[model samples]
Target: MDFSSKLLENAVYEMSQLPGIGKRTALRLVLHLLKQPEERTNLLSEALTDLRAKVNFCKSCHNISDTEICEICSNHKRDKSLVCVVEDIRDVMAIESTSQYNGLYHVLGGKISPMEGIGPQDLSIVSLVNRVKEGEVKELIFALSSTMEGDTTNFYIYKQLEGLDVTTSTIARGIAVGDELEYADEVTLGRSILNRIPFENSIKAS
Candidate 1:
């Protein structure tokens, strides 16, 4: 972890701050950048700056978008009445890659995790409930990860839609109990979606 220069040290520290990256890797990256042309580094910096400044969340589904609403939410071909509730945009992308789901999505941004200090209020649960309450939505599919936090979040949302006339379900447990949807292969994830079980059944089994 020794650095010859303060500038290199600071660069390594910043790069190492990224998840899963260590000091040695960060130094290698810094050296790689140093070897590259200045234009390459400038281009990388400019791209990151532009992404931060220009990206916005969709007003309807809260997914990443350039406009007020995401393309999925605005698409007329998607079934508006069937909603797949997920942890984040990554889950949305995973589900969409299947090409089996023709429904809309509700990205929760994150799940309820007490250890991490994440609560229902911290996510987009209210927007999801409102989407169901506004009354075109007939089905609510819980497509969150199978972890404890994911289950807790799903249960919370299921309870929120209790008095409403919507049918609720969760993707089948084809993936392992603690696996994330984003990590699952398309075939398994797609089959799970197609064979989703009732939310009540899922809750009862747990």
Candidate 2:
């Protein structure tokens, strides 16, 4: 698209570089910012600058944080022996929203994607093994997504932890309750069947 100013074009280009953002959306954002007071844009820019300048990764879990250790890792009430391994901080947020897990987390930073040139060495896998070797950890909950890369990463980590005294498990994949089975994908429907509980156990909550 043509722009009256090179500066506007540059801003649109930079914004469009963000994931899921297209050129049209980026141009709309740029135009919207231009319509606002200069102070508003300055605040937005300053916040981004401060974030990029000061954001830190949690030393223990590798999640994004403002401190060396994130709040989750520092919490005393969380079960340190039961660690949930996830792909990224976004997964941590998604799990935390459920408030069902009270265990600590080990963020892998990213999954093993051969096509993308990301492998076990590219992630924080060694630190996780070290954490398990400390002898306090008893179980590991694999909470990574059910994608091919996610599975490859989980299997790699599992192999690394072999004979290491920790019990490893994957988060169950299945269809959501109340959803129509006809709409469910074949894999999910098949998994739900394979992982089904006994009728008596399923009614325990009632």
Candidate 3:
């Protein structure tokens, strides 16, 4: 696309770099931002800048946070012994919306996708194993999506926790095959969490 102003072009280009945003959508967004008051645009820019510079990952679960630990991890009422394993903060948010689980969470960062060059080491699996070894976590709920990579990551972590006292479970198939947890309806997701089965049973069924 051609632009009369290079500033507009630059803004659209940067905005288009976001996932699911095309050049056309980015251009429209840039134009909308340009139409807004200068203070509003400045606020947007300042918010993005602050998000990138000031955000911290929770030391315990690796969820994005403003402090060293996320509110969920620090919440005394949450079940610390029941840790839900998820891909990232989005999934954490998805599960939290269900309000069916009172457990803590462990964000793996991503699944083990060989096609994408993401492996066990690329995720926060080691820290998870350490958490399990520390004997605080009594059960691990594998809440990753039902994709092959997700299953692989879950099994890899399951093996790492082999012979350990912690029990392992996976969310029920209320979520369709290959579906992401973030996309599932709150009711279905809640039911899945409530009806989670043993990791070994999931392996046998697979």
Candidate 4:
């Protein structure tokens, strides 16, 4: 390939590596980007380059933030005594879209998957425990998936907070089994949160 062709090929390859994008889609995107004004293309490239430079995970909740703490964490209107535990930031976005929850969130960063070599220690469970140990938390709602890893993580967290004063609960069955919390619709997720059940009682009643 010539110089210009080589640049196109590189762009296509990089775009194809993104999730849910294949070669054809990547080629289409590259062609679209190429059609934009030179300044617009430059801005796009600079934004992509600055993504890592500008964004960082909030230390308190582990959500993506531009500053030390995310806006949610800094908001005084949010309920500080209640926390919703989720697997990742995408799940946070899903729940936020619902506009029904008023509590803070704790992002686990990942679920506990022994088969994939991810354990409780690999997540932000310890940080969550520390947050609870502060004695300000009154409730912990587990919004993890209903998958094996999700269940394992939920149980692990329950065990960790066994002697705490706070109540532990999990989202209701509004979401289908084996589905990710991030993929659940806003209405379904909101309903699940509103109808959450105590984790301990849920297991015993099962």
Local distance difference test, each candidate: 0.90, 0.92, 0.91, 0.91
Which model scores highest in lDDT?
Answer: 2
Please provide, for model 3 over 1-206, each residue's C-alpha lDDT reduced to its tens digit, 9 standing for 90 to 100.
87999888888999999999999999999888878889998998899999988889999999999889999999999999999999999999999998889999999999999999998889999999999999999999999987788888989999899889999988766888799989999978997888887899879876
Instruction: At residue 129, give the lDDT of candidate 1.
Output: 92
Total backbone collisions for each predicted model: 0, 0, 0, 0
What is candidate 4's lDDT per residue for 77-135, written digit by digit as tens?
99999999999999999999988799999999999997899988789999999999999
In the range 33-138, model 1's lDDT, one tens digit per residue, is 9999999989998998999999999999999999899899999999999999998888998998978799999998889999999988999999899998899999
Model 2 residue 197 lDDT score: 75
Q: Model 4's lDDT to the true fold?
A: 0.91
Candidate order by TM-score, decreasing, is 2, 1, 3, 4
Q: Candidate 3: lDDT of 150? A: 88
lDDT of 2 by residue, 160-189 (tens): 998899999998788876899889999999
After TM-score superposition, the amount by which residue 20's alpha carbon in candidate 1 deviates from its true location, in angstroms, is 0.6
Off by over 4 Å in 1: 175-206
